[model samples]
Target: MTVTLKDFYADWCGPCKTQDPILEDIQEDWGDRFQVEKVNVDEEQDVANEYQVRSLPTLIVENDDGVVERFVGVTQREDIEGALESAGA
Candidate 1:
């Protein structure tokens, strides 16, 4: 199984930039077991609306089974990992 991580952020959001490294680290650590995708709220409003993202830097964790969790703002590595674990990835 694979863990799908969707990071929702706007280009103009500072926190979104701050979240880059954290996501990169997670990607590197998790490798192929996880998939990281970025969605710009402004550019991909349909996706943002579909996921019901209400704020910048929102994170949606899912697996082949579907959505597992929704996190708003910058989330820590451990938290993200915990969510992945919960998703059975």
Candidate 2:
């Protein structure tokens, strides 16, 4: 099963910079078990709007089965892990 987390961010956002490393660590730790993809809001405005992402660091997680969950703002590792666990990651 594949678990994917997508981050919507812009280059000029300070919080996006802060959250980037955390997401990178999560990617490194999770490896192929899960993956993180980034979408630059400035570059992908339509996609961001489709996800209703109005913030700098919005995270949308989806499983291979197509179950999805959305989170706004800077999230913690534990919270992300818990969500994945709850989603049967």
Best by TM-score: 1
Write model 2 residue lDDT over 21-60, tens digit each, in one string: 8877877787777777789999999988888888778988
Regions of candidate 2 where Cα sits further than 4 Å from its true position: none
Per-prediction backbone clash count? 0, 0
* 42 Cα displacement, candidate 2 (Å): 0.5
| Per-residue alpha-carbon lDDT of candidate 1 for residues 1-89, written as tens digits (9 for 90 to 100) | 77899999988999899889988998888888778889988899999999988888999999989999988888898998899889976
User: Least accurate stretch of 10 residues (summed lDDT) in model 2?
Assistant: 80-89
TM-score of 2: 0.87
Best model number under lDDT? 1
Clashing pairs in 1: none
